[model samples]
Target: MKLQQLMSQTRRAIDDYGMIHTGDKIAIGISGGKDSLTLLYALHGLQRFYPEKFDLEAITVDLGNPDFDLSHIRHLCETMQIPYTVVKTEIAQIVFEERKEKNPCSLCAKMRKGALNDAVKKLGCNKIAYAHHKDDIVETMMMSLIYEGHFYSFPPITHLDRTNLTVIRPLMYVSEADVKGFCRKYQLPVVKSPCPADGYTKRQYVKDLLRKLNLENPGVKERMFSAIINGNISDWTPRIR
Candidate 1:
């Protein structure tokens, strides 16, 4: 996907969901993956012409993995003129070594988000942007139904009363395939995650399952995505402009 296409879809999500406001400061979460990097570029490009005139800072929660690296990410941020920060944490050691829990994804996510939230607040950002896209929305809803027995997915905009911060998914309209294509087309300096449980998590299982189902029933993914949009779940509908 070209930058123009990415920005166009991002603007649609931002406008439909009432995400950005004038003078808003947003911290873009960077996981060093293609998705997050793609989001960083999208938001950076959007900053150039969006009416809201928001400021952006890129942040990452370092999980204390020996192999984890952020040099390329830092340089990318520098090139884009986006300030970058990395909140250091021993989350990986605590989860894999100290706790030794069989299911660590949930705990790890909580800890990482806590760190990220604290950093965003310290940095005085009122909003944070995640890299979740169209594929993640459908997969999450599927995971909820298969595991917890109900229809649920990440909303485009969520206000956290506890932290007094708003979370927005501006890339919600972009597809994972498009993100991959964008990354390859631009030669983005992608960073490989060093997490041991990278592909062994439940989300990966759901992603693979969705891919197989899509293969068996072509266009099933799109239908599931459509269901998410029209499912009438609380806060799923876009805000009226």
Candidate 2:
């Protein structure tokens, strides 16, 4: 897709969700992965001259990997002057040893989300944005349906009760391929997750499964994503738009 088309989709999501309000300080959760890095870059590109005045900062939850040199992130953040803070955690080790039987994905995501929320509160930001895109949304829907026998996926915008933080997914309309292509075009420094379960994980299996399913049924991802938006989610929340 053309860069203009990609930007248009991203812009639509941002506006549709009313994310990045004026005079707001937004913090992004960067996981050293393509999705996150792409998010950081896209936000940076938009922040250059966003009509609305706001500040952007990048935060990464370091799994405390000895091999992970965060200098790249530091450099990028410094270049953009976007306050980049790293929170060190032993969650990786804990998850591996303690949470072996249960699905580690749910726990890992919750912990990371807790950490991100804490960061938002610590930084005094009213909102937080994640890098989830079209593919992730579709895959999540598939995962939930196949395993939990339910139709559920991430929302484009949400407000948490405890912290009252607005979580927005700006790249919700963007594609994974476009993100990777944009990263390559911009030569964004790609950082690998220090998590030992990087490649050998059930999430990877689900990703592969989704891909195969899509290959068999063309437009499967597109239809699934659209269904989530236009489907009967009225019972899930009164805030359904």
Candidate 3:
């Protein structure tokens, strides 16, 4: 996808959810993956002309994976002129070496988010943007229903009262496929995740299931997204335009 298309979709999500306000300092969570990098680029583009006039920063919480590298990511951030920070943690060692938990995704996610949140707060950012897109939304709702017996997905804007931080997904309206195309088109210096459990997670299973279900029932994904938007789940409700 072109940068113009990306900014259009991103702006829609932000406007629909009232994600940004004047003087807002937002941190972009950079996981070194296509999605996060795409988010970083999108936010950087938005910073150029967004009326709210928000500041941007990029952050990555290193999981202590030896194979993970941030050199390319650092260069990209420098080229964009966005402040970048990497918080080092032994999350991989703790999860895979010490705990050796059979299911590390949950624990790893919690620890990673905790580290990212703390970093964001310390950097004086009131809001943090995640890279979750349309595909993630559908997959998460599927996971919630199949695992926890609930019909739920994350909202576009979430206010974490505990940390006084607001989490926003500006890519909520953009599809994952579009993000991949954008990364390829722009030659984004994408970095692969070094987590051992990268593709062996429950979310991957749900993602495959959603893909098959969409193939069997065309427009299923779009319908599911529409349901999420109109589900009246309190948090899912967008701010008044």
- lDDT string, candidate 1, 1-241, tens digits: 9999999999999998789999899999999999999999999999998989999999999999988879999999999999999999999999999999799999999999999999999999999999999999999999999999999998998888999999999998899999999999999989898988899988999999999999999999999988998788886656666
Q: Which segments of model 3 are wrong by more than 4 Å? A: none
Candidate closest to the true structure, highest lDDT:
1
For candidate 2, write residues 22-62 as lDDT tens digits.
89888899888878877777787788766778888788887
Error of 2 at 231 (Å): 1.2
Model 1's number of clashes is 0
State the lDDT of candidate 3 residue by residue for 32-116, as single tens digits: 9999999998889989998899999899999998888899999989999999999999999999999999999989999999999
RMSD of 3: 0.8
Scored against the true structure, residue 119 in model 1 reaches a CA lDDT of 100
Query: What is each predicted model's overall lDDT from 0 to 1?
Result: 0.94, 0.79, 0.93
Whole-model lDDT, candidate 1?
Answer: 0.94
TM-score of 1: 0.98
